[model samples]
Target: MARKTSLKDIANKVGVSTSLVSYVLNNKDKENRVGKETADKIRKAAKELNYFPNLNARSLKTNISHTIGLIVADISNPFFSSLARTIEDEAYARNYTVIFGSSDENNDKFIKVLDFLSTRQVDGFIVASPEESRETVLGLKESNVPLVLIDRYFSDIVVNTVMVDNFKASFEATNHLLNKGHKRIGAIVYESTLLHYQDRCNGYLEAMKQAGIVDGTQFLAKVNHQSLQTEIQEAVQKLIFEDKVTAIYFSTNTIATEGLKQIKNVGKKIQEEIDVVAFDENLIFQFLDVHVPFVSQPIKKMGQEAVRILIDQIENKDQGIINVLLKATLETKEKLQKVN
Candidate 1:
């Protein structure tokens, strides 16, 4: 490997005093009266030597790491992964490095990652507050950690939060099916014990009742992550076979994907026979055998905005809590006329 170069070597090569070089490199020369030509030469020489500033040591003097931590419920989900990449890119543009951690939807792992990142001297944080970690939300306020919650919100906690309007989004999706003449619409949701999951289910019920469907079973179906397909297949099968559900609405991308698979397995002809709509976005929906209506959440925009909020809170030390509700867009590839 080539020898590592230092500021002293660059100063000697550029024929300038080390103090002058330091002043120029640190941008302190504007007040020190150092000539710009000498500063330019020092910069050129440092570049040729591939000299990198010691940010770690410099951060110690300023008491700011210029870094942020991003924690999510699950990194495997494309929505979260896309959000992470967007946030990382935005943070990079702001000269901030972002570290990521996944909570795995477990309180233990959530607390562990929160504790681990807290020790890193991160300037701020962007967190997806999982439902099981409500107390953690309360504790964050006391820790003086600048925070922005993404994809979910706590009604009781005062904090900066950015997320799609889960209730409105799900409600609109169900309303779309109802407008398409779907009466016996079933909904599939995935959540262990989170309130946001409950919100989606509630939205489905509200929409069903507003459409005059009083029966309860058609409005609710809960599934775990691993048994997504099995649960969807069983629930949808019952809706088709026993409950006489002519349509279904999924509350997430994962559930939507499974719902499509179950519908296809039962028979592709069923697509023309029944109506379907889902809360989240997925590529599968884009190419489904028949055009099914679905709701699109702006995942990338949410990620970018969350980082901006976190940075603002960190720099301004403003404790004002904000709840930004982004609207969801609805898409339908096939125009199925209202049948109800």
Candidate 2:
């Protein structure tokens, strides 16, 4: 293989000292009082020589790897996949790289990924924590590792977090169904201890209460995340046949997809036999013959804010903790038509 180009080669081509080239290439020319013309010359020569700085060496010197670790519940889920894409774009714009991992809602897997990323010397983390991860999150905080929780966070943990107001979103969606004469509406949510899921469940219950509908538990169904396919189908059966709900509210896109599939299997059509509202938007929802209104979270904003807060914490360790709860909007093409 041909020899790798080095800073020395660029310096020699530009007729400058290696140190001067280093300062210019590392964007320290202003502080070092290097002339702009000379800095330009060094940059031009470095480009001509195809010089690429050794990130490992620079990291060793500055103690910054310029890498971020991102942990999500499931990368295959559309919400997380979209969030990850937005995070990648935002991090790239800020000159940082991201390493991604999926926890699959398993705390053990989450810890393993965290350890692997820590060993790789990532500068910080943006995580959508799974259930029973309070201790793991607290440990990271105690260790002074820069972290920002997204999508979900502990209510008592004091840390940087950026997430949507899930309770408000769910409340509005449930109320929308209620406004359409859906008194016996049901909700399907994950049976997890994560605060976000709990907030969503509470939102649905509160909306039902406000509508003068007592006994919300009769219409609410919780499914195990590990067995979503089977459990979601069972929940749909219970809600539709047993509870005799005319409408259903799904807490997440994944749940909504599976629930919709189960609805189809039972020969029910959306807005015809039953009205449906879901927490997050899915591409498939738009293509269905009927409209499925959903709560739209500001995904791009969430990702950008998470990266911003995490990077800020990484750079300024003394900065105060930040907790941001963004608002989600309910998107509907038209008013819900009550099923007879």
User: What is the alpha-carbon lDDT for the whole of candidate 1?
Assistant: 0.76
Window of ten residues with lowest summed lDDT in model 2: 52-61
1-340, model 2: which lDDT tens digit per residue? Answer: 3455788898889899999998887778999999999999998886566454453343344477789999998898899999999999999999999999999888777876876676577888899998888766776665567889999988788899998999999999999999888899999999988889999999999999989987798899999987999999999998999999999999999899999999999988877788899999888987898889999999999999999998988788788999999999999998556545
Off by over 4 Å in 2: 1-62, 336-340
The runs of at least 3 residues in candidate 1 whose Cα sits more than 4 Å from the true structure, single-residue gaps closed, are 1-62, 268-270
Model 2 CA lDDT for position 99: 97
Candidate 1: tens digits of C-alpha lDDT, residues 75-152: 987788888999999999999999889997776577667656755767777988765787666666545678888887
Each prediction's whole-model lDDT (CA): 0.76, 0.87
Candidate 2 positional error at 259, Å: 0.8
